[model samples]
Target: MYQSSTIINHIANFTSQRNTELLAFSLLKSVNSMISCLSTKIITVNKKGEVRDHLFFENNHCTVKDNSIEIDNVLRRSFEHMHDSSLAALTLKTKAGYSVIRLLHHDRKSEQFLIINLNEKMTKENDYILSGILSIYSNFIQLLNESQTDELTGLANRKTFDSAISSVFNTRPREHKEVDSERRSPNEIIVKENHKYWLVIIDIDDFKSVNDRFGHLYGDEILIHLAQIIRSNFRNEDLQFRFGGEEFVILLSADNQMECMQILERFRRNVEEYQFPNLDTVTVSIGVVELKKETFHITSIDYADQALYKSKKSGKNQITFFENMLSQGIAKKSDIQGGSVDFF
Candidate 1:
């Protein structure tokens, strides 16, 4: 068994350059070869509903192909009747239309399937081989999921951000060219091109008032409600995160700064107007930073945060731009508290 660090180091080497599907196939093949007569395959249908081979494991002189309408039908059926985490049967046929193993997955995203032949003609060796291989495969898939999920908001955590950032940030193809210097670096791995991006950090207005007035449970309820509102209003391109108590972060793309700020302001307005249950009305303060590809994480996060502090200090429930707020004396730190400024 490879140490977790060793596996991570291997993965790190492959970062930005590796074909993740092939790497996943290699991991499956390792488990497959450990069990005789075991083979594995992963298939995914495209946006157009066309079935395609995503990953396949080779057995002693035998191969697995991913293309098949019959397999697609069974896979889709398995998805319908039982959850991806469920243990269930999916009757399927091979490329030549021969009846093959029934498959069950532990996850839908990775689309790993444990194959079994229900035909009585199967040997005990085949059953043992399949069982052992599946046990290992399922463990691997579970690990992948644990890495991607966020504990707080049930959203795609920062662990899932790398690929997402790349698809939207890395614009030019010359960067994709193979050169020792041009390789996918720790930062370069997620570059994409052709759109302005914004990273908006949000904090619920007067969140401590809830904990102080009601209770921690009520505070949590407000957080959950705030999460729901952000999720519903944001576009699919945006990724939402609970950075910690009362704070959420959103990454989104827009054509320009005007559009980005407008979207965030609208989100702010929605929060301001919406009636949260058990509360009169809730408000949020947002600090939006326009992101350039290389300048992803700027000290501007602090600037944005200072802007947010201004919103809270002057008044709650407002959107504050870092540059404008910082230029004036509005963002200065103070030992003073409870005193307030005019509302926007």
Candidate 2:
């Protein structure tokens, strides 16, 4: 059995991890080590009670694909029960094992469920201790989300981008693991040799004109709506950020240059087709650069920015690849270095 002091110290260490996913995994591992009686998992579910991502500490783990039938049935029952009465905590026998489920957090829009597969039936004292641990974990997650998420769009903020990009460069491509299966296929996974990371900077075309023509309140609505479109167009595993002031950033993994170009082109076309209320056609300019482990981080960002500048100069609503720009003799290395380069 773990002492109270030991559990507190372990949770304190969990709060120091770099990102939300890492923090969640670390917390689960710590809890499993401290209390061997229960194996914990954190599952993210959408408004319709569909299991989106499942994180676990187990062997031969069941994923959304592998257990879709069972998961859907379970979620259906849970939701039905939730409608009748509050399901703050409940226990039942599942196909896999005996489990306890708790509503870690919920709003009108989304919910996160905490599922514990019990190794043993708990005593009264054990239940009390487990409840306390869940509260601690919940509070930690709330604070982390508040810090890392953008208030307006709910996308990742700039600080998260800084840490995520640095970690990507420093760590070998092999170190990045696969996320949920619903997001991407096995072929699209990020592996060091096969797939390379690409950075794309997206700028809203004539955004300032829109802000001037309409009120700032409507301008903010456009920003939020565009953010939603960006999220829908990219995979869940991809890193996205509202880099500030109508400029956004996307980091994606692709097998080749053509694939990268195709992806960006698709997004561009989607943005062009979407209609915005009481507004003229809205468009975007994109600059893309293939990120290499050997390249300086700031240089890569600058290259992407330069490509964006080139896109703006040539036309407002096109995608430009940095390597293509070099081949076309449109930009020189000195020109990229000359641009304002700053990091946070």
Best by lDDT: 2
Instruction: Give lDDT tens digits, candidate 2, residues 269-295.
Output: 999888988876899999999886666
lDDT for model 1, please. 0.57
Each model's lDDT comes to 0.57, 0.73
| Model 2, residue pairs in steric clash | none
Q: Against the true structure, what is every candidate's RMSD? A: 9.9, 6.0
lDDT value for model 2: 0.73
Candidate 2: regions farther than 4 A off: 1-3, 45-51, 58-85, 93-98, 106-111, 169-193, 334-344
